[model samples]
Target: MFCSDDPVQLQLPVLETGFPYGELEELLSFLQSDNPTVSPNNSGSEGSNRTLSSPDDRKRRRMMSNRESARRSRWRKKKHLEDTTNELNQLGAENQELKSQLDYVASRFFAVQAENERLRSECASLSARLSDLHWILLAMQNHINPR
Candidate 1:
């Protein structure tokens, strides 16, 4: 097994009939070959005595990593959806409350307008009665003084 700090060095290049492709194929063949130092029985041994990791092992690890990442992505999306639903419900309730307030205010406004109209009619009637009384009082005064 070769260990390197660079990711490019760690990855196996695609197999094409190019300058680096032949070299990569040779390297892959060598890595796929059995280890001469480790026997077949020792290959199954635990811990430090384990054989070098094969391509299959790397593929499995990569698959598991991708699966876990996908699960986490789904969880985040579900949480976001729930939070959005809750916010929408809260907004709807607030809107309903505001509408109720508007209705109450409108009803009060109409009541006040009706009272204002009634007061205006009453004022007009009172002014007419006052004018009639003033005319009657002037006539009585003329009859008493003859001037």
Candidate 2:
């Protein structure tokens, strides 16, 4: 009833505990005392009206606090999601780099295998040619020493 003329314009503080403990004592005193003051130059009717409006004021405070807490939780959730996204991106990049390194190692292994096979073939050919030369030398010695 204090702001009956401007009900839609009422603004409640968002925090429930933001009002000091001492202020609550003063408010209680005003409610219990024989004379209650509503506003400057206001009459008895407004003071009586405030008694009925007190419950509504308490409800408004509760609602405002709930809204503020909900807003903060949403912001925190968004930040967590953003952090997870960054981590996933970094892991994907690292995975790609590791894949490339594996490919490079595989290519090097194949090159070494090819080189080993070529060297083995060359050794086999050289060994065969050396055996043929030894046989010819033995045959010449026998012809020279026929006596």
Candidate 3:
């Protein structure tokens, strides 16, 4: 009986010696067969009686159920973590975009304010020049007509 963990060491000698093929085929089929005793679709009340017939069978069924439940729980947790990471990345990009827009709006607001100040200064200078012209015109009219 071969007890080594390496299958190549067992298979190489077995094949070279022309051993009985039927036993090898049976052993291979049994080793490869990993079908679960209870199918997930029929694990409810409908199949409970079969697993409950013997204490050993009940224990095995419970163990398999626990393993399946743990596998699903781990998968759900991994999916949730991935979803949270994606959402964080999306929100970060949106925040950066909003900051960029705010900066542009602020720059435009400052430029408009400076332009308004310049226009106000020019309007005051033009009003003062107009008032002086009006006074000069009045003096000219008085000199010409003596009124």
Candidate 4:
């Protein structure tokens, strides 16, 4: 078994044929000092300086990483749902505002159309009165000239 403290002198017969010794030493050193920021438990327990050695330790670490990733993914999904809901609400309000504007414009258009019709009818009445007055003036001029 390779000692964690003296990883420099540790050599594996399996890797001795092809792998470089210096790289193996570096790999062992890195694996032994895994999670250096995590302090040792204060429970006066044996193996306080336990490092990741067996395949089980690596599997456990991978499981923990997967769990954390799953948690973040759920959080992201919830946030996206909330964002989509807010956007939907905003669009609905904008749609309502546009509808209101369209209604007001439509009402104004109808009012102008009615006013134009009233003005056109009044113009026709005035033109008929002018034509009658012109006919009366011509009749008076013909009687005075006796022609």
The candidate maximizing TM-score is 4
Ten consecutive residues with minimal summed lDDT in candidate 2?
3-12
Which ranges in model 2 have alpha carbons more than 4 Å from their true place?
1-58, 138-147
lDDT, candidates in the order shown: 0.69, 0.71, 0.70, 0.70
Assess every candidate by TM-score. Answer: 0.57, 0.53, 0.58, 0.60
Q: Rank the candidates by TM-score, best first.
A: 4, 3, 1, 2
> Candidate 2 residues 100-122, lDDT tens each?
99999999999999999999999
Clashing pairs in 4: none
| Total clashes for model 1 | 0
- Candidate 1 stretches greater than 4 Å from native: 1-58
Question: Candidate 2: what lDDT?
Answer: 0.71
For candidate 3, lDDT tens digit of each residue in 27-93?
Answer: 4554334222454456477456655655765565578557656876888899999999999999999
- Pairs that collide, model 1: none
Poorest 10 consecutive residues by lDDT, candidate 1: 1-10
Clashing pairs in 2: none
State which candidate, 2 or 4, has the greater lDDT: 2
lDDT (10s digit) by residue, model 1, range 74-118: 888999999999999999999999999999999999999999999
The regions of model 4 sitting more than 4 angstroms off are: 1-53
